[model samples]
Target: MYPKMLEVAKSEGNKEAERSFHHANEVEKIHAQLYQKLLDNPGASRETYAYYVCPVCGYTSEKEPPDSCPVCGTKGKMFKKMD
Candidate 1:
């Protein structure tokens, strides 16, 4: 778990590991929320919309990404479309 890794990294005073784990933890939270949303509404996946992910932060969106990533402020155009 990224959070657990982050905690260990913090305790060890490893700044690089802390940063990496922090980033992963943030993305993992977004993924979990997205997965929970889909689980809550099982039919939501029936749509033919495409998914987009922020290259910088791994933020995901359906149909279309926002003008800027809420987590990292990466532009929508920078997001990569999922196949």
Candidate 2:
């Protein structure tokens, strides 16, 4: 879906749409990889950690948030804590 959207955005010459689709696509790929890693180690001990989500680009991080979001460059203060 993201790839299709990205292509559509590109074809339409919509830079903002293209960027959004591209970022979402890349983030989804990262999420899949993280899920795969967890599946590969089903018996590993789990640790609790606070999660922070970037409101601007949906970037997620455990423990502490980055100084600036790698996805959209949003400031750390803009991130919301996920309870």
Candidate 3:
């Protein structure tokens, strides 16, 4: 769905839509991979750390946020922290 939206956005020359849909598609792929990893290791130890999400692109990071969002170039300071 997101990939299709990205392609449509690109075809229509909507830069903002393209970026947003592309970011969502990429993030969903990462989420699937992480979910698979957890499923493969059900007993993995859980560690406590701050989780940060990019307000513009939905990019997620643990421990600390990046200096800049790799997806949408949003500044680290703009990230929303999750408890």
Candidate 4:
């Protein structure tokens, strides 16, 4: 949705496009706040964990990785989402 909003801004440069971009950003901020709130809740912390997947070998992990994959030795950039 954010990319589509940016495309709208690029295709039609006007006040409306700028407004749409700000609105989209605002929505994203709200969503982040909601997620943070959920994570901050007492019982929810144990239920939630960071998730990642190696694109090269389809290995999934419960945390975001850096530099390399622990399972199949893939690079960090090759990681995708398992969520």
Top lDDT prediction, candidate number: 1
Instruction: List model 4 lDDT by residue over 1-83, tens digit each.
Output: 77776877777776677665665575456557656867788686567676675665445555575578654578987777654
The residue pairs that clash in candidate 2, if any, are none
lDDT of each: 0.86, 0.80, 0.79, 0.64
Model 1: per-residue Cα lDDT over 6-78, one tens digit each? 8898999999988877777778888999899889988987766689999997989887989999878899999
Rank candidates by TM-score, best first: 1, 2, 3, 4
- Identify the candidate with maximal TM-score: 1
CA lDDT of 76 in candidate 2?
91
**What local lDDT score does residue 19 receive in model 2, on the 0 to 100 scale?**
81
Comparing 1 with 4 on TM-score, the higher-scoring candidate is 1
The local distance difference test score of model 1 is: 0.86
The C-alpha stretches of model 4 lying farther than 4 A from their native spots are: 1-4, 7-11, 44-83
Candidate 1 lDDT trough over 10 residues, lowest sum: 19-28
TM-score of each predicted structure versus truth: 0.81, 0.78, 0.69, 0.36
**Candidate 4 to truth, TM:** 0.36
lDDT of 3 by residue, 1-83 (tens): 77777778889999988876766778887677767866887774265557798998788876688999887789999999986
Ranked by lDDT, top first: 1, 2, 3, 4
Going through the candidates in the order shown, the clash numbers are 0, 0, 0, 0
Q: Tell me which of candidates 1 and 2 scores higher on TM-score.
A: 1
